[model samples]
Target: MLSEKSMELSRKIIILIYGRAFSFILSLIIPLVLTRLLVKDDYGSYQQLIMIYAIVQAILLFGMPQSLLYYFPRKEISDRSLLIKQTWSILAISGLLVITLFGITSQTMESIFPDHHLQPFIFLLGIYIGIMLSVMPLQNLLILEDKETTAMWSMICFTVIDIIILPSAAWYNPTTLGMVHGIILTSIIKFVIVIFYIYKNYLSKLETRESYYQEQLAYGIPVGLTAMIYVININIDKYMVGLFFSSSVFAVYYLGSLWAPMFGWITQSASQVVIPRMSKAHNNNDLLQIRELYANSVEKLAFIFLPATVLLALIAKPLILTLFTDNYEDTVPIFSIYLLLLPTYALNLGWILMASGQTKFLLRLAMFMSIINIILSYGFLTTLEGDNRLLGIPFATVAVTWISTIVVMYKSLNTLESTLSESYHWKKMVTIGAISALSAIPIIALLSLELENKIFLISSIVIYGITFLFTSFKFNILNDNEINLVKSFLPFKN
Candidate 1:
């Protein structure tokens, strides 16, 4: 029988998944519209701008949002107000510091992206970052309040607004700067909503706690810095690509290099489902539960990820051409290379490390991986030319990610008092992956026939879907209980 906590976790995962699915749909449509409406260079510049925000926001939040999950449950009801207030105070101060730093460093920053006129945008960027940073703690507060559904709705609203605004903004002004304005406007609107919600729900209940800030800072800074390193690891390739190729070329690579949303959404949703439970289990020193959750999560994630990875890799060319048009045909190989890393993301070690308060280890791992990425990216850029140079980054990424995954697994296993074999079954993982890959063979054969590009893509997806589902169920890739859990959320059951 499932425990109440397990049932609640399932419910939250369901809510978050539905929210992410809707957001993902909007996400797909937005890129389609913007990639076509904006020029290639403009799209590339927009991507770079977003990368900048990602790095800055990751740094500025400093992982304080994570602390809420750790600290909130321990506090008394009256003490909650103090925690909320202190968190907001710290975020505001950090946001101000970031804005001032950016204003002072605008010229030096401008030199990095030579083609873009960043001088004017620097001030706007600072404001945008400031507003975003200030709102993050409050946003996390919602999750702590068990209002993840509310937070998810806010995300959906913003995405809806983005879809309506971004392409129209690009169409009207038809420039990178104009799209920047659209981004800023959308952010401002979202920021206002967050502020209002935070104030109404949390601020009114606030009280003073001089020591709470110190506690949150101690816990949050390392996590934040670690996250910053992660940002660098993922994004250094973009800088390398931009430096070597034109903005137009960078745009093509960027589109190709996007993480598959199916994998991302599943990983993210699973993390959300497991982290709090894992944290509670760790707090109680229940190694047994930790090991159980860890094993179950990897198995479930592998079941979904292995199949999707194989399917995407098989149909990369048709998928790229159909979605981004023939001009993006070069993206096919890069996309395929990125797909190879999908399995690495199946590891849920970060959640475990965070739950165990081993964030400094994550920081160290991120540093090691980031350095490796930079060195390899540089080597590739110097040694190779054209699209091969872009492909090299993801190749390097897959290697580094695997290395990091192994180290994390070894370290985490020692801490949990479990062997690798006990935590997750290697034989099962390999078997599942092999089975999923073999299932794609018939679909690949069909793709060789001459057909309309869109028709071919659709037919390939439909054929693969039916084949994989029938084979997987017949083989019980996911067992009966797992199958029923998934079906509970769907509208219809077979």
Candidate 2:
């Protein structure tokens, strides 16, 4: 039987899974509908708008949002309220400065994007950014407070709001501005929901703590810087493509790099839940608990994502064609290369550094990694244009991710005073990788025959999924505890 702690963790994980699932499904629909509704150039413009918002928000929020996970669970309730107040103050102040700067340098900002309309949308984007930065801490607070069900419900509500508003907005205006309008409204609704809940349940008189503010900023600044660089790590390629290539080209590149949300959902769900737990353990100086949490989290992420990524890779071409239409057939290789990121996702060692508050090391790693990623991606793009151009971004991503994961692994072990062999289940992950590969044999065999695209895709998914799950279960890829945790959520008993 599982311990009480394990059961609680499992319950939190389930709520997070639900949240991610809701967000993931909603995410898929918005992109799919937008891609189909708008022209390729327009779609590309919208993506660029989102990319800009992401970069700005990463800067605006700094690391204040992450500090919630680090400090909330450990802090007294009064201090938690003060922390929230201070974090929001930072976001509002910083947002004002940035928005003002953006308004003043509107021309400079416009020059970065390929479209003139995107320049004006910057205002809406700025407002959305401010709202988002404000709302972020509240969302993380829910997770920290272990209000996972409430968090999940909030996400579901937001999804419902987006689904109803965005498609209609896209259908009517069908332009970048329309999309921005829809997004702004969506953010407003969510902001109100989260803030109202926090205020009703958690907020109190402003309890100012200067030392707490300093501590959060000290820890958060480096994490924020790391995140800012991570923006470069992930989005620099798109920026490069958008800057050099045309809007239409960027659209294809963007679509190609669209990772199935399943990979993100699994890893993100694990990270969000694991971080608070690990932070609590680290605060208590519980080394054994930390070790178990780290190892178990990685294994679960791998067991869930490894097979799904492999299946996606095998059907990358047809999948892209089916989702985005044959116009994006050029996205096949890009999507295929992007699929390679799955294995690397299994090496989520960042949680160790994050929970341990070794954030400066994370900043250093991101700095070095981002520089290398930019250079490699640029070198490839310049050298290989045309059909081979999109390949550069994913190739750079894969290489950089592998290198960063290795470094993080080494640093994580060093931080934990453990070794590679003893610390992580390396052999298990490798075995799972092999299992995922071998399980694709049937799908590969199916590819040899001529069949309808839908039939081929369906057969590949069904065949590959059954094989992977059967192998995982038969080989006991998941431990008894994990199997039980999963079974608890199912209708039937284990």
The model with the greatest lDDT is 2
* lDDT of every model, 2 decimals: 0.77, 0.79
Per-residue lDDT over 1-494 for candidate 2, one digit per residue giving the tens place of the 0 to 100 score: 56878776766777677677867777678878988899888889988988888777876788987888887788887766677777777877886777676675575767676466567777678778877777776657777776777677766777788888998999999998888898988888878876777667655466555655677789999988888887778777788888888999999988877674235666666677788888998999987888888887777667767887888888888878778888889888877887777766777469888999999999998999999998999898889967677677778977888899899988888878887777778788888888998999999889899677889999998888888878877777756776667667554211
Instruction: Please provide TM-scores, in order, for all candidate models, with all chains considered together.
Output: 0.92, 0.93
Q: Pick the candidate with the highest TM-score.
A: 2
Q: Per-residue lDDT of 43-127 in model 1, one digit per residue for the tens?
A: 8888887788888898788787787777776667778777777777788888888888878777666777645555556767777
Looking at model 2, which ten-residue stretch has the lowest summed lDDT? 485-494
